[model samples]
Target: MDTASSSSNSTMAEFDYLFKLLLIGDSGVGKSTLLLSFTSNTFEDLSPTIGLDYEKNCWGVVSDIIFLFLYHEAGQERFRTLTSSYYRGAQGIIMVYDVTRRETFTNLSDIWAKEIDLYSTNQDCIKMLVGNKVDKESERVVSKKEGIDFAREYGCLYLECSAKTRVNVEQCFEELVLKILDTPSLLAEGSAGVKKNIFKEIPPQSDASTSGCCSW
Candidate 1:
């Protein structure tokens, strides 16, 4: 993976972000895999996501940018409760889909609209659409144009990513962080909402060496 772009300076202000990001999609949309790549530098293709799972990431930034990571997963029924609980103070939310699974992608709104409403009502939460599993072009069921249009309709940024190849995954996160930075108040609000994680104290070099975790 390419090294993340963080400023040379060291301070909490440089690393702070005002957005809470949540990943929502169908069971097999590679949400967990993507989270693993960003947070722990691990990528494990897992079995179907059952109830719900979560992880967090912290990114270094330059200029006025701050990046924080939030990853969450849930089943069809668990969607309502899980999301309502997690996205309460999110800075941004990423709704993901598998490019090769139209059914999975199609039902995303049905399963997650409530959660979207929860965060959207707060005004601080920005959103983005992510199409996952882009490496499987031959099996692709959704067109890039279609995804972009949907995102635009919802007023969100859109990007297709392949976690397996590490393609555009980092870029997608970067875009979200930069978008949140564009609004400083959101960042200030997120800072108060976000609690520090124990894993963050771990060194970056140590995390890189621990890639590809998760038995799945």
Candidate 2:
């Protein structure tokens, strides 16, 4: 990876509001581990977030909204209340789960559906799924095709990466920001039925899901 002090890093700095991006999945899915890498460029084992954890950051075009990591063990009622409110100004969401954990990936739909209901007004909110822990060749539970297929069914972007190895970890975040600013008309997916309004843009999300245990 190129150093942030490099010339390439300067080019990546151009953007408006910092988008509010969420790291979500079931308990022990490595959501917290990946968050460590993202916010501090480091990794460590941690406990489930008590209520909601926050990370504020700016990544092109989006003014950082509060990034909330809903603990894996958060009850549905609590999530519906606390996490739901943060969506009022959310720009995008990054839902992640361990690739070897099928239950985590399966619950992606449930979270998405809930968001749609909670933030009905924020239709422009972009969401993507990340399959974490690809570094573990053995004990792999979910496959790439399955992840891609789920992304399609939910109308979201999908990719897999390993936080431990730093494979596609940074790139996924970069692509997410790009997707936020990318006018759907320019994308092949835009040609079909759904088309994001070029005039209006999604605001950064302040709050942001999960079922399978997130353990890294």
Candidate 3:
């Protein structure tokens, strides 16, 4: 289980598949912090995103299967045009909200989810509802049950994690990626209708490592 830092000298060609994932929510919801924690295994106070941010990481889910993670943080209003463009090819969408802010949690359904349905081309894209900042238990305004209820109604997975403490940060991505891998339609190829069953014959290995990198 080797998890590489963002500075690791890894190349895209080394991976078997590439998956585009987007991180979205209201500004100041810790989307950037969550991303920083995931890619570098570190956390830092971050300002509200002015426009867009991108990061890449590789996860070794199976012995031979490598997943290239492309993450885009879309939180600014001015970048709506540019951000909407990213929604087209997304394979996984991580809808994040700050646990201390009820409004951010409400926007997940009232705002973000609607934008996703409007722009996402992939109907089968996996969605995960993330309630961030669980470490601030005292400051929490949103309950875990509220998050679970939203996830159920929104038809997505739900997880509450603290990017600051690194709790469930890696597990959050791992679960989403595993779900994507299990979805056959997501693995389908070109317009010619050719499909690849990459994992069908490969037995699950317990010793696979996780490696990835990130950039601002």
Candidate 4:
């Protein structure tokens, strides 16, 4: 498995708030595409990530300055072990799913949320649920209302974005940062104050089934 970093490292002195953010979702859910689009502001053909991809972004300034350290982990089951290792100390998480694939959207509740509860550092860590690939309307199997409903039910900030078209791509990250800042502890002492998570275990997935387009 191959892993890569996106840019040169910046010292902690370069900004005020440094938030470690994690990107996670099932394979082909456009996690990498969103990251590339957000950081570089352009869409490029991307190979499926093998292990992990890292990016650093700095936003705001002076009293409002914030630095985001993003980690994009491969969604393939084979890399789950490697990716889960990075979950500790994350101040924010972006859980992505493909709006075109109903299976990916369903797994957010059935699979990904369990992983979040299992490995995330803090149960209260700012979370954002992103439904990606909105540009593919013809192929979409998930609706915007479904996305919003899921977010409301699960208590996460939600957004639909089209990385290929750059729709809501920048705003996605901007909103997540705003949410992180809304939590008081995360902004207290820059890097030194990152909260050690007290995990709230998610109950085991039952044999229960939810019928949808992907059921076939």
RMSD of 4: 10.6
Candidate 2 off by > 4 Å: 1-15, 59-81, 184-216
lDDT tens digits by residue: candidate 1, 113-179: 5558754535756788999988899999899998988887778888999888888888888888778
Backbone clash pairs for candidate 1 read: 18-187, 19-91, 20-90, 20-91, 42-212
Whole-model lDDT per candidate: 0.66, 0.56, 0.72, 0.72
Q: After TM-score superposition, what is the CA distance of residue 148 in candidate 1 from its true location, in Å?
A: 0.9
Per-residue lDDT tens digits of candidate 3, residues 25-128? Answer: 98888887887898788999987765555665765554534444445544667645455556766678999999999989888878899999888889899999
* Cand. 2 Cα-lDDT: 0.56
Question: Candidate 1 or 4, higher TM-score?
Answer: 4
- Candidate 4 lDDT, tens digit per residue, 44-79? 768787765666666764355566667777788875
> Candidate 3: minimum summed lDDT over ten consecutive residues — where?
199-208
Error of 4 at 126 (Å): 0.9
Output the lDDT of residue 179, model 2: 74
lDDT for 51 in candidate 2 is: 53
lDDT of 2 by residue, 168-194 (tens): 777777776677657442233322233
**TM-score, prediction 1:** 0.76
TM-score of each: 0.76, 0.67, 0.82, 0.81
Error of 3 at 205 (Å): 42
